[model samples]
Target: MRIAVTRPEEDAGPLKARLEALDHEVVMAPLMTITPRASVHIPDLPWQVIAVTSANGIRALPPGHGLTSIRTLTVGPQSLKAATAAGFRAEAQGGDVNGLSAFIRAELTPAAGPILYLSGAETSGDLEGQLGAAGFACHRAVLYDAVPAAGLGPVDALLRRGEIDAVLLYSPRSARIWRQLTEAAGLSAQAGKLRNFCLSTNVASVLPEHWTRLVAESPDEQAMLALLAQKGRSL
Candidate 1:
């Protein structure tokens, strides 16, 4: 099975390796480039906890920011691992923004001080707005930006030759970008023949209506990989 990986290069490494180990041919078609913001300033506020929505957020932190001392709340296991590896004490993990907001609201109170949210320039969820509505003070700092790829990489040729079998979509933005690139390359018909494995329903919804899509039971990389492996077995 030949699978197209459309995640950013840095985030695609582990998944690509894992897919290859499962005996699947992997194509690297990074849909975005993650650029860390230069000169990120940690505000001098009374921050009781830190919130991280993506692993890229943790990677954007400058060394010795003294944020490691604070308890961090991560959106998923990957972010939690990245946070712990960065020397921060990760207190909890949420499946998504809503889960994270609920966790924070249930565990902490308005007296717990403000939360500093580390995020990218384009955020899919409104973590700050959600927390603020719950009487929690949340400050967001854009630490990185995911710039969309100008064109599809090897995917254009692969689809044209009908070599691609499946595609992995991690986010809605990437899914939309993949669709746009495929259309631009005049390979939309070829792409429609391939199966799309999405990390979540939101990711799948962005794709074209006629394309075959599979949504993972859980909104995480591990679950998506498992679904791919299962589909690989059936093929």
Candidate 2:
């Protein structure tokens, strides 16, 4: 199966390697480029815990500022791995914002001090607002920004030829960008023919209604890859 990956190149490396390992032809067609925000300065506050929604957030942080000592809560396995690799004490909060919020509420109290939420410029959930309303002080620091791709790149040609078998959507923003690019390139019909393996329902919701969409049971990369493998076996 020929799979189209629409995640940023940096984040797509693992997925591409995993797909190839499964004996599938993988196409690198990133719909967004992640750029780290410049002039980032960690506030001199007594932050009790750090919240990371994406791996990019961890990547954007500069090393060696007594950061590794902080307890970190990550959105999923990927972010947990990244935070751990960066020497921070990290724990996975699954892949859902609501689940993370619940975990925070259950594990810590408002008196535990403020949480530093290292996030991208554009986020799916209002983590700060949600945590704040829950009586926890959550300070969000925009560490990176996802810039949309200018064109569809090679995926456009493959999509038009109907050579692609599946499309992997990691985020709702990427799915929305793919929709825009496909419609703009007049390849919506071709795109609709391929199977869409979304990381979550949120990602699936942004894709074309006519497309054969498969949402992962869990909102994580492993689940998405499992969906691909299952689809491959069926094919």
Candidate 3:
């Protein structure tokens, strides 16, 4: 199967490798571009933990911020991997913002210190609000921004040629971008023909209603990959 991966370029390599390992031809069609915010600073405070909702947050950390000793809590496996690679003492939640907030509530307390949240300019949900409502001090720093792509010409061409078998959508924003771009390119009908594998129901919700959408049981890449493998076997 030829799979189109629509995650941002910075995060697409691993997913592409995973798809290739499963013996599928991969098409890199990033729907969003990650831009690091200029002059962003990691708050120099006695933080209880460094919380990240995406790997881009960790990647956006400025060099020599002197915060590596702080324990990092990531929203998922990929963010955890990024935190670990950045030489921080890191742990990961099950996945998603709610789980991460719950994990922090369960494991840590506000009395310890404030949580330093490194995040993108646009977030799907209010992680800070959830923790703040629980009497926790959240110092949020907008480290990056995920900007939608202008077009998806490569993917449009592939869809028109009937060469793509599926599309892997990781976020609702990216899925929305794909839907809008495909419509703009006049490939909406062709795009509907391919299987659409989404990381979560929220991600799938924004896609065209008539499109064949398969959502992962869990909102993670592993689960999304499992859906692909299971569906591939069935096909």
Candidate 4:
């Protein structure tokens, strides 16, 4: 199977290696570019906890910020791993923003100071809004920005040649970007011919109804890879 990976290059490395290990041809087609916000400042406050929905948020932290002493909470396995590797005491909830919010509500209270949320410029879920509505003070710091790619690179040729069998879509935004770019490149029909393996239903929902789509059992990379492996065997 020739699979196109649409995640940013930093996040796509492990997925690419995994797909290649499964004997699939992997095409690096990053639909978005991740840029760390250099001018952003971390607020000086008695933060009770740190929250991050994406690993990119953790990576975007300025060098020597010295926030590792604060307890960190992550949205899923990947973010948790990143936080842990960064020398912080971190824990992960179920693979979604709602679950992370629920975990915070259950574990902490408004009396426990504020939560510093490290995040990207645009997010699919409103973590701070959700927590704020629940009487929790959630301070969000935009640490990075994910800019959409204007065109597909190598994947364009593959789609045109009808050589791509599947596309790995990690987020709704990236999925939408892929759809828009392919449509603009006059390769919508070719792209629709391939199966799309999405990390979750939200990601899959962005695709056209006529295209074949497979969603992971859970909204994490491990589950996504498992779904791909299972489907690849049957194909």
> Cα deviation of 148 in candidate 2 (Å)?
0.4
Off by over 4 Å in 2: none
lDDT of 2 at 67: 80
Relative to the true structure, candidate 4 reaches a TM of: 0.96
lDDT of 1 by residue, 104-218 (tens): 8998897879999999998777999999999998999999999999998778887888889999988888899989988988988888889989888898999888998999998
Compared with the true structure, what per-residue lDDT tens digits does model 4 show for residues 16-101? Answer: 88878878888899999999988788988999999999999999999978899999999987788889999989999857887888
lDDT of 3 by residue, 1-235 (tens): 9998888889989888888888999989988889998888666789999889999999997777888899899888899999999898999884998789889989899999999999998886689999999999999999888988899858777788898999988888888888899989899998887899988888889998899999999988888888898998876
Our tally of clashes for model 3 stands at 0
The deviation in Å at residue 155 for candidate 1 is 1.1
Judging by lDDT against the true structure, name the best candidate.
4
Error of 4 at 57 (Å): 0.5
Model 4, backbone clash pairs (residues 3+ apart or across chains), number: 0
**Cα TM-score per model:** 0.96, 0.96, 0.96, 0.96
